[model samples]
Target: MNNSLKTIAFISGIVILAYGVYTLFKPETQISIGDVDLIETQDNTNSYITIAVGIVIVALSSIIGKK
Candidate 1:
């Protein structure tokens, strides 16, 4: 049971990390009019937070697994 839980955490962490990276690089808003492109960029605070959370979770899971 514990191993299964750890596996789930690891998978979820990877997914969250991937999602954070995707959001960090992807544009939030884009508009193209007559060959003119307008992109609305936002701060990456959320992405950073998500990435941090994922890293922490992964680290915790691995650390616990070693015990």
Candidate 2:
């Protein structure tokens, strides 16, 4: 990994983490796709996933570029 990559990862991680927290607290949304309607909701499983991914990205930014 390089400094640029680490920077990108760090920024991306922050964005993902922020969005994850935001969505976790926000209400669900209803959407229709090709006549199939779906209601989106956040659960613990998803919360964990986003949090994990974000943490992994941030950790990678710290660990990957240097010793």
Best by lDDT, which number? 1
Tens digits of per-residue lDDT for model 2, 1-67: 4888889999999888887787677877889899899997557678768978998889988997777
Report, for every candidate in turn, its global Cα lDDT versus the true structure. 0.89, 0.83
TM-score of 1: 0.80
Q: What range of 10 consecutive residues in model 2 has the weakest lDDT sum? A: 40-49
Candidate 1: worst-modelled 10 consecutive residues by lDDT: 58-67
Each prediction's TM-score versus the true structure: 0.80, 0.68
* Per-candidate clashes, comma-separated: 0, 0
Tell how far residue 28 is off in model 2, in angstroms: 5.7
Give the C-alpha lDDT of model 1: 0.89
User: How would you encode candidate 1's per-residue C-alpha lDDT over 1-67 as one tens digit per residue?
Assistant: 8898899999999999999998899867989999999988789999999999999888887876675
